[model samples]
Target chain A: MSQAIDLDLLPEPTTNVAEYSVSEISGALKRTVEETFGHVRVRGEISGYRGPHSSGHAYFALKDDKARIDAVVWRTSFAKLAFRPEEGLEVVATGRLTTFPGSSKYQIVIEDLKPAGAGALMALLNERRVRLEAEGLFAAERKKPLPFLPQVIGIVTSPTGAVIRDICHRIADRFPLRLLVWPVRVQGDTCPAEVAAAIKGFNALEPGGAIPRPDLIIVARGGGSLEDLWGFNDEAVVRAAAGSLIPLISAVGHETDWTLIDHAADRRAPTPTGAAEMAVPVRAELHAALASLHARHGQSVTRRIDAERRHVTSLARALPSVDMLLALPRRRVDEAETGLGRALRLSLSENRRRFGEAASPLSPNALDGLVRDKRADLRHAEGVLGHALSRGLAAKRQRFDRASLSLQPRAMSARSDAHRQRLVDLGRRLPRAQRFGLERLRTGLDAQWRVALSLNPDNVLSRGYAILRRPGAGPDGQPITSASELPMGAEFVVQLADGLRGAVSTGTENAGAARTKRARRAAAHEATTPAKQGLLFE
Target chain B: MSDLNEPVLPPDDSDVKRMSFEEALAELERIVSQLERGDVPLDRSIRIYERGEKLKSHCDRLLTAAEDKVEKIKLNRAGKPTGTEPLDSA
Candidate 1:
């Protein structure tokens, strides 16, 4: 109240003095506020944190228990912040205090901002982790299997630290690989950006580029506190590791230390050395395995060859001998020849013996004996006829004398003369009859002699028919009618019209014998070529 | 499957060197199994065995020839590698 009364008592300014507009005064205020507090660091809980304006400026408010002040962070500075500013989160904002003339308001233009403490940072980290995890960035299925043997290994770490040395040494002990170190700050404000950039840079390398692309990546750092290791847990680094095309192994801090990178990477090693060990296998064990395989190969091949050889030997033993099969037909030929010879001899002798029996009854001596018996019969008949005639005449004379005495003497003498004449005629006729009988007998004898001459053996032989006989036979020996009756191993004679032929009986000469021999030869040939016979039979 | 009458050719070294350690090892194991099957011809078996030996030796050489090389990547103001320097292990 006193200040207001005093202002009222003081003299008003003269009209000659220059007057100022509201815009001018507001502009002057803005300049004074900006110049007075050029740069200030404010600690407050974020509230009403809103917009990135169209001019790339963020409008927000920083408040505490006593008061609240409006703030702005330019997009350029906001883009550089490692973490986002959210409502209800305490943060330390570093920037200039400036006044906006349009609203007649004063605000801090933030240049840099960070979480106020480790707890605040952790809260931000957990928020980010939850968001990213919800996005499936940390899904187990998203992980890739690390190559059993990587040709080139890209590393994201501080080149000046012992982490790289341990990794290199451990890899050398196991299996060596080409290491492409991408040096970066492992902690601090710049650490996340540098590490993320390194990972992205490795991923962008062309496979056939001048610098060989890495088959796998290892992001590693030595042990540190939560603040020191916060970079690995940063969203930029975790997203970069998760999005990498190559398989990644995260080896940050000690064995128990955990980072968001460990969750996002394809594999997590307890330490830097552990990552190296996982990359390759031991060399000596591989050599031993190869040797064992070589021995097994040799043994299997030898066993297979031996089995085949044994099979061939057994097959050879199952075949038959050649000589035994040939003798079956030879014996059959000899029996056939002997049968044929016996049949021929029986036919020839049967013909000769029949001829001899037929000729004996028709011999010329038989005809002569028949003629002599006829002549003797004729002489005895003549004597008996003469005696009967004389007796008849004497009885007739006595009867005639008695009858003549009673008859005339002239008739009696005439009868006697006639009787004497009749007797003479009878004697002449008897002689003629005997001559005719002898003529008939002589004609019959001549016909029998002609038949006997026609049936002679010598005459039959002269007509080109030959008789085959065994020669030099004794008187008791009849003509051989069968081969069985003929002597064995004897030479036989064949009589023809010209001369006699001597022939030895060759028992093996016959068609049957020849055929049997041919069959035997064929059987022998077949036995010798068992393979051919097997094909034929099959 | 290998043909019994196919001509056997010697193993080529440049070809073997181009293979990765895993590829080489896998090929070596394949050769051994093929030999164990005993269906391959003698000449082919011998040739494959020789190739297996070369692969084994190549793997051995890879392990023996390796030396740990530590290097520091040097970056410019824009964080691009300008060159490299030997890294101190200590």
Candidate 2:
């Protein structure tokens, strides 16, 4: 209790302790923070980054798991950032910390921003891809197909790097071509700018200028880590690649690594060498293909000519020779002459047989029986002919159908079919013509048979006419049938109604006279039928 | 198909020389197909085939005569491209 009373009685005269204003406190704290952390790297995920402010400053917070610190990048510093800071991206913020007097909050004004790790860098890359893709930068329709053969190839890569050399060597090995190498810093802060400018520069060149404009562009780089190859992901580089007038092939890294430029490029080669391979075809293979094509063209023409020649030769073969045409008609005339002699003998025999039948029977019943027999034979013949014609037609139709279905040449088959049709038509007409000829000959032979019966010697002898026989009158004569057969003064025997009588015939050369009475009947018969004899030698 | 007697004008040797590799090869292919199809008359076939021969030789020359080495872009002191220079010594 006494100590408390003593303390209460103590003087309140502490005057040396300095008091400061809020502004002064804030300024001192800012100064102290700057001095302590003037140059520091804070590795943390970026928070609340929404791009640059209208005033051209970036304000964001860098946060680790447990703590967060405000970060700001000035306009100039933002332009130089190794990569654009993205929200929730783990980055190493390098800057000094200064207090904002107005907010009474201390923040780090970031000088340079870099992705802290590969994982965070990939995340940032993916986010940027989503944004750029949404703008249709990587649309497939925007891509241009590379020319089959490019006369001039423009390459965007560092001249000093092995990537350019590898590309050149590969291109030379496959097919040599004009190459325009736009030497650029492949990686670093200035890399993206230089590469983009190189692409745009090539695009601006006039076509067929002193330097021929490139038909193709290759933006290539050797394989490297994400950070080393980060320049290819720059917006300028990707946009330039997407906007190239000529087709562009991006070979930024190994097969597994893909940069934003790869997406934007017309083609994405796995390596610089691969890009060169894609640019041109092998010269040797092309030469071989062209040579084969030329040879094939020659062979095809020869084949066509051969085919036409064969066609002409076959057509010539189809025409009948002149000898064949003449021989056919000449043979038919020979056949007709030989057939005429046989027809005369047959007609004589037929007339005798008919005469015998007529003398034996004139009954109506016999005539009816003969007619029935003839009709039955005709029916049988007609049935057989009908069957034969139908069968032949069926077979011919079948043959024609098969020929049509076969793969034989159409024109040749069609011509042969016409010939076959003509033969068939001629064959059909021949039998009908033969039947008409037979009917006419039968009517003529019946008339000749009646006249021959009238000239029979036995019938004439019974009519009080003696048949005269004379030596040397006929080659083998039993009787002299006409006065023209007797010589000038030959003795002849004449058979009268009683018996044989001796006679003498006298005929002068100037007179066509018959000395015997037998000559009268023979002469009258000749006068009545010069028509029957005419059939023999007409 | 056109008439067999109709004349087909063929590209001259000079035209083949001016044609690019793709153009020459395409024309050569077309000629081969025309002959192969037997659509062209003998006179026309021979003429176009001669043209194809010229095209083939021209493409071969294009392949053989390509610029062999790469050329580097030459920049001025201000870092602006002035022209180009051979990158390799040859």
Candidate 3:
């Protein structure tokens, strides 16, 4: 606060000054910086870092414990940076110290910047990781599960690097997946942004767009120093990895080197090949599993069908036999036969009764009348014959008397006796022939009576075959050979060997029912008629 | 630039690209399982099995179709993709 001691040591100002314009002063200052500090190297921690401006210039500040100075890098020089400048990164920047008159600030126009040392870069990385972790960028919950099978895998790495080759080779060895490489500078000023942009670009893809969306992503790079691998530790790259909708795997540097992206990624692999292995399963293993599943499914279905078949077979075995199901119909058939026999016998008997009634009027009385007529004719014929004979004898006697004078009397008498004998022989033979013809007519009448008796239904019934007759006046009433011909609840009669029995037709003669009925009838018949036992089972 | 040394490139066929290896494998597995279950009708089973065989061969073909093609993504000054080139000399 004291202003007393240094007055004599201060220099005096001259009155004849040049009065230069702001541009002139700024120009002189720019030339002085370009010449004096051209290609100077400065080591300091990066601070207030900013990207290359649209005009191809970067604005930033370089700071030490005592002071901080504004710095910049032209786009051309920035392109040459081996590592990206970040806040709190101790780096050695080589470029001229220049001044921006507009802001009235002095700065180093950086031609190149590199991390001061591996330890410094690690410190910077740890600090960045701490800040990112606080923002939940590396939270376990933010990580996504890798797809079991990724249709495509997007890789963000240098195309010429061994990292990409390792990844591709490993993936080919395992299960080949469609690969899309986003060529990027793995370790340079542009590395972080390029990596981040690649991640975002893959995410921006539509699922079925011209450029297929990657199901998984791998950010990979080969082994390098902490500074060389620092791009993966960058905030932008970490955020991109954390924000990716597609699952990501970080494989940077050797197995011992850990990057911030590793924490942010869904999975972290020790090397690029390892990341490839994590991306897809073994092809043969999956194929084998599918085959086994197929086999198991087949076995399961076959067992089910087989068990069902066995159940059906058991059920079939428990069912009733076909013959047992036909017994009732067979019994109905027997009953119908019996009824027909009885009905026929009744018809025949009725016919016979009607015949007797009609024949009674034409009996022996009529025959006696015929006999009287025939006797009268015979008597008349005998009278006529006697008259004719007497006339003829008188004529013959007259003729004989006339002829007697010319003949022998003894000869004439002999001839008249011979004629009387011939007449007697003829009368005897005619009566005998009529008697023989009468005996023959009686024998024929007896034979016809025997035939009529034998043809009677009663005779057939006595032979053990019954006739069944339905009481109606239609074709159905004639006789039923099949149970289907009988209507439900129809009345019928069965003529047995000795008598007739009335019965009703029960119309339940389906195939199975008829079979059971027939079987029962056969069994019963076998019991009653041993001679038919052999035919029952047949 | 390395692609200049490469031989003739294969003709562009979008069908192969449209069918993903993963999808083909999944379909093959599904078909095999369906056939194994045997719940499918005989005709249907045969049809699906035929489809499964096709899918299996598709997967195999996909794996063996080409060698790993490592390509460099060509970019403009602004880092937008322009095209691609083979990463190797051949």
Candidate 4:
């Protein structure tokens, strides 16, 4: 019966490759998950911890004091992580077990982690902070000043959130600084990797020459729980911040809030507002500075002007005019003028003397000739009368003697008188000689004297006619001898017969010829009119 | 009270620019201090007092001008500028 059963049984232990529909496979997986990974508390040290990446998925391990377990965290669960898990950290993970069929790997899918021992995890973090702070890692000296004018500020936070909006509004209100948003998780398990990546990306862009490098970076977010700001506290973020070439301002939370990033950054502002203030200078303050400088400059200029004015006033005092100072030079000039006038008078006298001496011979004979000619004519008349008289004289010698005596006295009296007597004698002898002849001769002489006197320029001059005697003469009253005589001007005398009444220059006369001609004319006038009594007899 | 109504002369550029803001203020204060001390020669003391008065006025004018500008800027944000006009001018 055993042989027959073995022959018939099992139908060759059917190796049908375990038939399964897609639905059945999933059902089995669900069943396995429900059965094996039912709510359990697993003790382990976390290792190869990947808290959160882009998809908000966390992958890590839960390790015991000796061993670790693989685990995964959905973004929803990771969003609530109180503390960050790291490799080699002992923890008790509470979660439902799950299996991944693709890799046939079992993971804890941890919902929660707590310190394996009794002490709180936060205490360890605080101690770590204290240790870092003790090393001067959080010192104020470790910080750098924010840029005055940030051209491009790198913002690292979630794209769709009030934090970014608040930061943006604050920055915009304060100053129109350029913003470069790099959306990354500010909290949750994925944040550390994303935050580190954002920092590195900005750094790499500079090395790659993708664009002009940002002047400064603003690692900013609104206020949050410590865990919410955990990514900034991450070791990766801290190292990246320390290593980055760009200066960074950590604007993590409200004024009261502080984070690990605050310590690691080049500068840590208490709030986003404080960060903005640190970044930009106030416009009002700058304007005030410029105004003050202008005022100071104006004041300095005024002082210099005042000093110059004082100098000018002092100089004015030094240069004042005084009567005593003016007296000496004025006296000297007056004395010189007196000397010049004396010299002019002396020179004029000498010129007159020289002119009179040179022109004496050219006289017109109106004075001496009248006397001498009349005397000679008288003598001839007397001689002829005497001859006639001698013949008759014998008879009346006495009478003749008496006549001679009377005549002798009369002969010396005047030739004109004697001529008139002879004429009377002739008239007696001829008895036909008329008084007309004698009268005519006398009238002729008187007429000649009148003509000569009229022709004398001095006659009219004596009657108050001013003779404008230019220094020279042509036939006209002008001083020019010829056209060529118009050379340097000559001095002229307008003589009034009395004295030199006026003087001028014929700017057109040759000075030498003009002077000589003037002297000759003046001399000719003097020669024609001898002085009345004395020179006429002499 | 007499000082309040008294006229003041402006400082020259050289005097103003020689000192920092704080130093200038301190010097102005020193001038006031000297005036308060009143231990100088009459002529010298008068000059010092005059200078102090001028400095006080200058400082006051400077602060007043600054305040005026600040007020104007704030007012400009709302509308137009208005205030007590400067003396002896349109």
Docking class of 4: incorrect
Look at candidate 3 and tell me the lDDT of residue A145: 80
Model 3 per-residue lDDT at A379:
96
Clashing pairs in 1: none
Residue B31 error, candidate 4, Å: 23
Provide the DockQ value for model 4: 0.06
Cα error, residue A205 of model 1, in Å, equals 2.1
Candidate 2 backbone collisions, by pair: none
Q: Candidate 3 on A268-307: residue-level lDDT in tens?
A: 9999988998898887787676566555545655665676
How well does candidate 1 score on lDDT at residue A471? 73
Q: Which stretch of 10 consecutive residues in model 2 chain A shows the poorest summed lDDT?
A: A529-538
Model 1 Cα lDDT, one tens digit per residue, A381-469: 99999999999999999998997776888978999999999999999899889999999999999888888877665567765566667
Q: What's the lDDT for all of these models?
A: 0.80, 0.84, 0.77, 0.63
Cα lDDT of model 2 by residue, B1-90, tens digit = 457655445455566777778988898888788888887766767787678778778877877778776798887766667877888742
| TM-scores of the candidates in the order shown | 0.49, 0.54, 0.51, 0.42
lDDT of 3: 0.77
Off by over 4 Å in 4: A1-33, A41-44, A47-84, A90-92, A98-107, A111-142, A200-212, A322-538, B1-90
- Output per-candidate TM-scores for chain A, rounded to 2 decimals: 0.46, 0.49, 0.51, 0.47
Docking outcome class, model 2: acceptable
